[model samples]
Target chain A: MTKTHYFYIGYGLLCLLGITSPLLNPWEGATTVWDRLYLKFYGVSPYGGFSLLSFLFYSIIYTGFLYQFQLFLTDYLSGRFYYTAIRYQSLARWFIHLGWQMSYKAACFLVVLATVTVLIGLALGDSPELTVSVLSNLTVIQLLIQFLLNGWLQLMNGLMIVFITAWVFKEPSYNLIAMGLLTIAALPVLNAGGWLPAGLNSTAYLSGQWEDLILITMKLVVYLLIQLVVIAVLFKRKNIAFY
Target chain B: MKLIEVVNVSKSFKGIQIFNQANAVFEQGNIYGILGPNGSGKSVLFKLICGFIKPDQGDIIIHPSYRSRRADFPQNFGIIIDRPGYAAGLTGFENLKRWAEIRNQIKDEDIKRTMRVVGLDPDARQKMKSYSLGMKQKIAFAQAIMENQQVLILDEPFNAMDVDSVKVLRELLIKYKQEGRTIILTSHNEEDIELLCDQVYQIRSHKLVPVNTMAKV
Candidate 1:
């Protein structure tokens, strides 16, 4: 099987393990393998035994990794495709225009993913209080806006990393290490600065923290616009010859 | 009328000069051959005309009527330069389909017809990664002509093709020329140049020197 297929299988198994482990060992003091695994990674006790929160956090981070992996794969494949497509003299400018096309696709994928995950969460009979509180705190429109903002930010971040690395490195493989380093370095800053709203932090927006949401949304938009302009200008000036 | 004019174009890579004050002109409805040895700026010239690279000290001007602007690619351009790259996981038809979707100028039948013209199996399910070198070349050719563009710029397009395939492609190109499309091709093959080009220029000393095939004959 392809690496992507293996990844999906492994991710699905992990999700199943996360959900079922808590149910299997429901006693307050009893600890399951999932709890132990979570402790090892998080260095904290899993709240509520087989905590759905912990599982959700793990899933979000894993999804980020998956998104990055797919971005890398698509960039590599599209670069190869563009290497020849650009040869079609009329398509020489296509590399610059690809940003919007990819962003649109990523946005659609994010919406579908969010809807499916929410549906699955409902089906799994998540905590009644958790679901009620979440639903009560934010209307559907607010939730959608937040979800779209979060997805756009994620997409912009991924694109920025690829574009910056592509500008610097001649080989696409070199950008993998650069992407890893950038993600590692950016995560702590984004979290500490309250830029990224994953896990429990994401729940804050539902409780009428519109100010923070608006501020973050504005910053992300400005940053993405600047990055897009830089990428377009650089690509226009760069010589794209296959070696 | 001139379709493309390259005026005093100069280009270099990390201090290695490729072209210095090189100039060339291509008129409409003519097959122009650029003849040069390897690493002699034939490909560079093609890249300049295609707006793939910027010239250091000059401008490439595509006729305003043919192209929208001075800085943009000419409208309806079909080109094959270097190696043809495609998504490794996609079938040949899928790859072509993606490109066709971009412009929305051609239909599925056009794609299939071009594939047939290039002797590629349109229904083949094999991924592009598994395609042989000859198959890849044929697919690239299929992409170039599928749109029925007014201009074609091909760089060593016949590389890795068998004799029969090459003959078929040559005939196809001749047909494109007869239909009044401007075609520019770079080749080391003398026979291709003799049989195909209406006007030929040899790349000499970073400048184009016109060749008279009839005088030589």
Candidate 2:
């Protein structure tokens, strides 16, 4: 990890804290940890009308650190890729290790987010106990799973986007195509709830239904698998010409 | 004893051929020098030998004893192809430690010793971003030799170094060769080729042609 990685983590903490502060304050809002989490993820609904500005703000903030990960991949490829790649006997192993690093970083960020949310709830004198909420009929385990899967899968999808774009465009500037696709997917007119990459990140698409959540999980897995397969195929033959 | 053989290897990028049926033999306990002008596929040949890139038409055969059961690339080979990939925020010691952890074969003491060998202060707190080009090159050279790799494939191993540093590295390369390690390298300077390399090959017209070292000078 580099010094810049710490900056990204710090930035993520600040963003989480800023967003959580208003929603979990003692004066006028969510009284419990679960309530705070539920409200935080209560993003725009497609069936109901959507707020363009609010969705855009949350989406960008949520996925901003991911752009840094993409940039890191690009830099590593250009610089020390050969240095590291040759240490391993096979490039496939190196690629797998890279994927693992991304996954680990993604999981760590989610943990940090959750930890901050809980700490804020504690400071606000919100109850530590996970309580029943009328916001949606989600059990504690189900809600936790939903939150984790949504956050992790979104980050992984973001990584997949970087790899696919790099393979196709062979340059970092091509990541703009990924950003544009994300923006286009955010529009509610597409009605692409949980199917498109951007729509899959929306909490509203989760819908608190076991069947819906399961379906969404399957869809996310399938989408991520397809993207991973595409990347593996393209990258298998790619010359290590990052420099 | 033959170590790595590039048998009729051919490669191209974007329809521009880099090598065509190029073949070379690298044997053990010898420092073989590759000489070619810029864009003449010297680096590409090194990459193929290291399995960083595959040849389009032929195989790069590695001796069975050097082949690892775990990976497609040969085991126990130190390599320097392009830029050294050190984290700018990390000190030289920290960077080496991270890479050493990959193989889990060396300890902190080994790293410190290797740093010392390269004339770097192991305890220095200076980050890699603050390092001079020469200092970075030393770090790159340190990592390649730290594990005592049996084979070293270095491209432009003498790049960006002072005269004294180059001399120190030359003596070290001779010591390594004395230990019976296979070393293949490329350098723009004929002095490096003449002083260190036991045999030399010059790349011409997509082929590896052995140059009579004594006659070339």
TM-score of each: 0.76, 0.90
All models: lDDT? 0.65, 0.78
Candidate 2 residue-pair clash tally: 1
**RMSD of model 2, in Å?**
3.1
Q: Name the regions of candidate 2 deviating beyond 4 angstroms.
A: A1-10, A13-31, A43-45, A121-134, A167-169, A191-193, A234-238
Local distance difference test, candidate 1 = 0.65
Q: How good is chain A of candidate 1, measured by TM-score?
A: 0.62
What DockQ class does candidate 1 belong to?
acceptable
Candidate 2 per-residue lDDT, tens place, B1-217, comes to 8898989999998899999998889999999999889999988888888776789999899999998786757889998877676878889999989888888899999999999988899999999998999898899898899998999998887689889989999999999999999899999898888899889999999999999877664
Per-residue alpha-carbon lDDT of candidate 1 for residues A1-243, written as tens digits (9 for 90 to 100):
666668767765665554344442233431322222222122111121334454444444434454554455454543344433443334435654455666776677556545544554446554323222323344444555555665467555666656556654555666667555544433433345544322221323333456755765676676677776776676667575543
